[model samples]
Target chain A: MKARSFRVLTSLLATLTALGAAAQEEGVLDSAVVRNRLYRPAGHPELSLSVGLPVQTHLTAHYFFDVGLAYNLFDTLAVEARAGYAASRHTGLARSISESFLDRQDKKITDELEDLWQMNFHGVAGVRWAPVYGKLSLVSDIPAHFQAYLWAGGGVGSFKRKSVIQCSHVVDRTAGVCDDRTSLDDRGTAREDFWVHETRVAPVVSGALGFRFFILDKHGVKLEVRDWIFRDSYRVNLLRDDWEAGRETGEKAPSPGLTHLVQFDLGYTFSF
Target chain B: MRTFPRLALLFTALPALALAQVSSGEQPVPAPGPESAIPPEPVSASPQPEPPRAPRERPPPVTPAIQHAPVRAIEASAPAPDAPVAMPTPAPPPASADDTPDLSSEGPRTTDASQQRLVNGAPLYDPNVNVHIVQKKRFADEGHHEVVLYPAVVQLNGKYTNHVGTALHYVYHLQENFGVQLAGQYNWYSDESHFNLELIDKVREQAQAASSLLLQWGVQAGVEVTPLYGKFAFLNNSLAQFSVVLSGGAGLGATRHLIRPAVANEVDGQTFQVPARYGDTGTKFLGSVGGGFRLQFGESYSIRLEVRDLLYTARVDKVDGCSLSDFEAMETARAGNQPFSDLKLSGGCKVEKFDGVDPKTKKNYREDIILGRDLVAEPSSDVLNNVSFYAGFSILF
Candidate 1:
């Protein structure tokens, strides 16, 4: 199953890269070519970065990261990906549920995310598109590219929530311990599980403004601004129903809402 | 023992507050001028000062019909009371229909006006000096509109009340009373309280978060009126005011979700056997409530905070398809030709009369049903959490 999934992922990436190469071949006036011919090619790929708090509690959200990518598509569009490494912990009600289930003294349930998916490792891949790819010139009446458009795409986003809950005696209402207590399946027993995501399904939509620049003529750079609306399997309920009384994990979120991202994309789209 | 410290703190603070208010230049005197040399009464919980009146050119002498009114005097002396201590004047005979004074209430001698009066207390018309900012928040009331792209059967999670399910809600409030302009609020919730707790017993902790679309069709309207308008605060120029409002309405809702009850059994002692069942269903409930806001946000759009407990319920999937009364016949039929399993019929799941609690029995039984159903609420749908989420806009006239 893993191998088959990997094959599909590889083919998908290759196909996307081919589309980019093919689109560039159309001599669609390479955004890089236009920049080199008209504006001074910039030295660095115009990138936007941000390192801020991951609005949660108890856990120190004091972390920072940058966003941008390395790729070229067009003056209005570019295929790039964003990566950030920050210290964040899973928390909130979701984590709280998992903690409750994990109490060995109470539920005694052991099966958590580690048992369900990541006993060893997990991986992530993404595709970022910066529509309205360009730079901004000061003192120019022309409002930076009259930038606006619709963006719909997907990426991986997942957070963790860890909570500790209290578990006292568990007895059926109006009944004694009729059911035997020992050797219940770990999944069915009282336990806590860490809520983690193997892959976050994110589709994107956006509008942006900026200008394009090229360095050495072959490299296309853009400082684009985008108001991105990410449609992920947005979970409304961070907690799930099936979660055992004390043990629960993973995102039992129902899809409903969307996240907003005001990202600045700066990357060099190699212009052949 | 722990609560004792808190009580002491409050006791100490109350008197200190009165002293502070008295020391402050402004006197929240129940009566104005030297002749009103009365001791300050202890209505000090409220720091609001009575607004100083603009000197009126020699007014006529005091009316013989009413003077030395102890109640008014007490009300005047105690600038701030634990509760409302209005004037002793026989309210100008309710001149209007809307503002008619409800005297049946407040008829008791709560206090005497004469006993309450401060030396510097001055007569003032507008006492609510605090900034009585009446903000109006308006929510776009477009009927419940949403599209569910998910195509999985959502099971019912034993969480939220049966008040909602997979749905949409559009809320609008005219924060004066219980008057809300609802473009629409439709909710679908079923009472699954009797949901096969049996199957759950057999199954392990493995759970699934069902999606749901809950729509609540209700209207809310309330107004925040500064009861004692123009009553000034001593610390800051901002005035102090108490706003009261009453709001209520009714609406129906549609709820739909999946009920995949799982059961677990001992399988050869090594592993447990479990099976997941598919049951998609919906129920409707009528919800209403009256709540007061401690503080309505200040202006056009301020944070409107409130503590309200709304009551609503939904029905769950019924396997018996029979009411409790039907059980009488089923029990008798089972003794002869009918198999016990065959007798299992789904009567619309209803909370038994005994479901709430049995006072005589002093215990909860099957008849005692828990109100409301649960929500996952439907597959791919996330209405709100069990604790739930409710937001709205409020406008006051």
Candidate 2:
């Protein structure tokens, strides 16, 4: 397998080299025209639209769409505002594994794990810097502009936490009776009766590194690796009376600390 | 006895006759000839004469063996070229009057003294020679001056109120490796308790107006060091340039803690009120360290991406709740450079810009502002510890 992959890579490199040679011989990449047509002059504003998929997420798969507006403050600096909607879905496997482990440890868990939840929307304002710029000769005479940039900022996010009771009854079999009369199955006929618990908004911090290939002066494609960090807390719906009584007792629920959601996005941007 | 003797004699005689016949068949005697009597001249020179030919009316069909006989006969009959034989030489083609003189036929000629001197003089230019022409050096001896401005939203730690702000940075490069920078940022605080409705209602019940934390603007002056600068050849012989810049600076900023007076609410025989407030507005000294990469597009424009940590002392007097006198005392102590108990860590990109000048107007083009200031206020403390990242465009003149 390794040898095959190496062979494929070598073949690709050879093809690129051949194409570059042909392009150079033809003089198709006129430097003068490229200089005039490929770069955005100073002090121009740009707008971009992007869609991204979370390559690595804590417990779910997330996909998002973003619209960004940026203003060039200087030759190397820009301020930007980005707003986007992100949707999350549970992989189901993670929940199943967790439930299975819990079931083995304590047989009281008779129900499956709940589906993962996510934030539906977020807003961010940050600065972007194109710190490195260079040209790559992928095709002989034609050069592609390559740029690497990084950005970070803080924003607000609206997230909903939905969970269903994992067990219908957690009773002592020796007593032949269930102790917690208020358990989901003891009172409710359906699972949806005690499914959703709460919805809350939290602060989100994010950072990203973007590599862009400028095919033209005003148009380019960008690949970005981004991470969003935030705090998340939710009810597990495991215990019975203690869970309900803890709220009145001013006891804090168990929290999952900070969660990091990493995503990769490929999109295009047009600069004016 | 006489019969036996006769049989034995016959058998002996028969054996002798058979032996004699075998000898005669094996060796046929040569016919006596006058040629043989002449005594063969030195054996090396004597050729065995061809066997007496048998004349027949029709020639035998030519076989492979007969076909090769003529070649051997011709080789034997041909005379050697150097055997004292004479041959006529062929006449050369008639020379034409227009024929050019052959230089190879001319004998070597000695060079004249002047001619030798001329030959030794400076060589003349030849178009066929591979001459390397050096291109004008690029990115050499250029001025390094740039300015950038950006706006960003900051979250203090992960739980503190969010601040929206803008920052301006100025950099002047003394050499390729070093530069001085001045940067300033202004931020206004916003209410974040709304993220938790329960917290908002509880705070609202205690204070008719929503409580909020406020952070004023700050400025910093620092030195920037660019330790590395490099270029990469992109597609089509295009060059892209970049640099790594590091910086450290110190500055001062202020923060305000505010709360509104309100009536208390009792529910389920328990009193629910907003948490007591800490001391109000005060100023603190701050320090920042950061590094970034700058990618230059052309002579006038570039993009910068940076990460920085802003550090400052936070003074929160938990014992006294929202007391003006206590806040003043803390301010006095801060002015006296008293040691602070809390340290805040905050950094991220505050701004990134890409500027382009309009060709027709020859002026910097501007875009409509898309982000508006957030005015909501919520409960806040004097602590600010956060990290930030920024991207922006810069102009170099």
lDDT of each: 0.28, 0.42
Best by TM-score: 2
TM-score attained by chain A of model 2: 0.66
Which number leads on DockQ?
2
> What part of the reference interface contacts, as a 0 to 1 fraction, does candidate 1 reproduce?
0.00
Which ten-residue region of model 2 chain B has the weakest summed lDDT? B123-132
lDDT string for model 1 (A150-266, tens) is 333444434332222222233331221112344343333534333333443334443334334434434444554433344423222223333434333334334323333333455
lDDT (C-alpha) at residue A12 in model 2? 22
List the candidate 2 regions with Cα displacement exceeding 4 Å.
A1-224, A227-272, B1-145, B151-159, B188-214, B230-240, B258-280, B297-300, B318-383, B389-391
Q: Cα deviation in Å at residue A187, candidate 1? A: 29
Q: B74-187, model 2: which lDDT tens digit per residue?
A: 111111222211112221222211111111211121111111111111100111111101111123213467897654423222222334455689988776556788988876
